[model samples]
Target: MSEPLLSIHDFSVTYDVDPPVHAVKGVTLELARGEILGLAGESGCGKTTLAYGVQRLLKAPAVITNGSVMFHDASGEDVDINALGAEEMRRFRWDKISMVFQGAMNSLNPVAQIGSQLEDVFEVHRPEMTPRQRRSEVADLLELVRVGAQRARSFPHELSGGMRQRVMIAMALALRPQLMVMDEPTTALDVLVQREIIRQISQLRHEFGFSVIFITHDLPLLLEITDRIAIMREGEIVEVGRAEQIWTDPQDAYTRTLLSSFPRLTGERGVVVR
Candidate 1:
């Protein structure tokens, strides 16, 4: 097998409370370089928690109780992300790994123009770039996501939801990170917009050669776009397999349940149930 771009071993996270909720439990998985790995489960199954935990984006009360997240970068350097200090971690984020957060359309700065927000990513990360260069780069990023460059002058509210979503994606791709952690990127959009977002993500992944850790509750979409799928339930990864294998020959009962949850329009219904 190829060297994994990222590897998680026995990872666990817990929310500290009167009765602590174990959010993620001993989940182990691997994401290969330039591959799309989907984390599929029903809502509150710890899918988002796992993604946040791996990226070290968890807030207080959500403690990572165990395990290691090892990231192998293109430079042939292998580092345990858990070991990085705050400054190093800050530098690591966005430049090496970026996230397109869930409900990203809402995440954009409502007060800022799209150009200013996109330019901020470079201003922070690529501070050495001249002002003209930053503007050029921001325009390119907007175009990369298929949003018109003129839309850069528009406020977040001025753009449609789909356009705002595309803007979020463009911002995430600004630094050309080696891996992207996208948490339910298509959530709350219409079916056609969702499909378009998925198509753009897949296209960009292929064109840019970056691996993706795609987190979503939809198994059907995962099967369509990801190379591999990991099914999570109650904070645990109950199944991990090739996308096709998970669809055709699921080993775990929970996997089958998630598969059956999305009904096919044409296929015989009973066939999937059995």
Candidate 2:
């Protein structure tokens, strides 16, 4: 196997409250350079918490008690994510890693045009580029996500839910970061739109060769698209294995229970849709 692009070792996160709640417990995981890893669990199971912790995006009250996140950069430099200062972390984020946050499409500026919103990513990260260049890049990004460049002049409220989601994805892909963490990206969309989004994500990964950490409660969806699936329960990883293995023979009771909770399709088992 190729060396891991990102590594999380003995990671733990705690919510400081009356009798603290341990959100994540000593979770150790790794992402291969160009592989898509799915993080599946029920609501409040710490999937998002773990993702936020890895990127040091957690605020006070939610603290990282222990652990380390190491990034093996393509430039042959190993980055200690936890040790980076404010400025360093800021520079490291979009340039190396980016996140397609849950409800990210809905999070776009309502008054701003779609193109300008995409251009903001370049404005912040690639400030050296001229305004004309940024606009050109924005058009390219929109087209890449399958969102028509004509929509660039439209506002957030003007686009469909899937189109907005695609725009958000385009923004995440703007810098071509090595790894993109997507948390419940398909939520609130209709089944058809959800399938389209998943297809786009899989195609984008193949086209750009960027690693993805897809987090969601949808086990079957993960089974369809991910190379490997990691099942989380109460902040701990109960099972980790190849998507086929997990679908065919899950060792953990929790994993089996999760699989059983969903209705099975007729004919075959362990078949990957993507």
Candidate 3:
């Protein structure tokens, strides 16, 4: 195992609505170097909230009420992300940690070419690089994510959903971040394409050595790709265990319901469809 990279110590979140809703409730988790930790829960269960909060992306209405999210830098310093100011977080956001968000395709500039948009990352974080160097790195990133280098010149509108997602993955990896937060990475992708992306990401994690926080709703899919899983419900993590162990022996009723929900193509559920 590699060094401990990030720690979320008993984190909880609350929304400051008319009647405040607690989203994340005392959730404690950690990720080691090169590890993949999956956050599994249904919609509105705060999986994405936790991921975005770790990256300091929460808005005004939503507030982190308790706990600390510490980022262990490559220099061996522990930086508390929640305590940082706006400018400080700007320095850390994409350079040390990155996110491949659910709406990442639309996050790209509609008017800009894909490679030029990717160059913005380099421009902000790696300003020393010339335009030529930035373009070279963008091409390399495309290849790293198993996409053709030529697609870099095209705008986001020209690409399919899978292709756009692949571009987002490439952009996330461009900085060679030590940790990445991915929420429903293959959300709009076909099952086959989703599998391909998952396989590539797992391979890249092995090759490049970055810890991943994977958020998704598919248990069978998560079972196939993740190292560990934190099964969550109504804003709480009920069980945590190794992926294989959880798949075989889930400790929570919510976890069991989720496991049973997977449509096994050859099982009883399949009989109805076939």
Candidate 4:
């Protein structure tokens, strides 16, 4: 495998309450440069928590109790993400790593134009760029995600669910970060649209040379898109292996169960026999 872009070791997160809830427990995973790593598990299995913890986006009441997140920069510098200060982390995000949040399509500002929202990324991260340059970049980003530049003027509600999802993807790609953490990006979209989004993501990853941590509960979907699959259960990774190996022969009972939970359609195409 190529050099690891991100190395996470002994990571844990907890919600401090009357009795602390250990949301994530000692996760140790690595993402190879330019490779897609799928994190699969049932809902509430700490998949999202791990993503948020890695990015340092967890808020009050939730704390990183242990572990280290090491980001290997392209420049050959190793960054200890857990050690970054507030200002440093603020700048680190969107530049080194970006997140295409779960249901992010629905999270877009309803009143804001798509172009404006896209430009906002540049405004914060690339402030030195001229207004004209930002506008041009925004248009380019939209096109990169297969969303027409003309739709940049449309509000979030004006676009279809798929289009809005594409817009979110465009935003995530705006900075061309080395890594992207996508949490259930295809949720709520129809199967066709979901497939399209997945295809776009794979193509974009190839073209942009960025690594992706694709988090989802769909083991079958992960098998199709990811190079490696890590199965998480109750705040821990139960198994990790090549996608094909995981599908053909999962060592962990939990992984096998997950794969079996999704029914497969066999026999004639376009014909459903109940």
Q: Candidate 2, residues 1-274: lDDT per residue as tens digits?
A: 5779999999999999989999999999988999999999999999999999999999989999999999999898999999999999999997789999999989999999999989999999999999999999999999998998888999999999999999999999999999999999998799999999999998989898899999999898899899999999999999999999999999999999999888666855554545
Task: Please give the ranking of all candidate structures by lDDT, highest first, separated by commas.
Answer: 2, 4, 1, 3
- Single out the weakest 10-residue window by summed lDDT for candidate 1: 265-274
lDDT of 4 by residue, 1-274 (tens): 8799999999999999979889899999989999999999998899999999999999979999999999999999999999999999999998999999998999999999999999999999998999999999998998888889888899999999999999999998898899999999997899999999999999998898999999998888899899999999999999999999999989999998887777675634533346
Query: TM-scores of the models, in the given order?
Result: 0.96, 0.96, 0.95, 0.96
Comparing 2 and 4 by lDDT, which wins?
2
Q: What lDDT does model 3 reach?
A: 0.88
Model 4 scores worst on lDDT over the 10 consecutive residues at: 265-274
The TM-score between candidate 1 and the true structure equals: 0.96
Task: Give the alpha carbon lDDT tens digit for every residue of 1-274 in model 1.
Answer: 4668998999999999879999999998988999999999888899999999988999989999999999999999998999999999998999889999999999899999999999999998889999899999988988889898888899999999999999999988999999999998897799999999899988998899999999998778889899999999999999999999998999999898877777786876675546
The Cα error of candidate 2 at residue 128, in Å, is 0.5
Q: In candidate 3, what are the lDDT values of residues 1-274, reduced to their tens digit?
A: 4588998999999998989989999988888888899899999999988888778799979999998999888888999998899888998898889999997877888788888888899999999999999999998988887778888879888988788888899888989999989998888788899888888998899888998989999888788888889998878889988999998888898899998887785667552455
List of clashing residue pairs for candidate 3:
none
TM-score between model 2 and native: 0.96
Model 4 residue runs over 4 Å out of place are: 267-274
RMSD of 1: 2.1
At residue 13, give the lDDT of candidate 3.
90
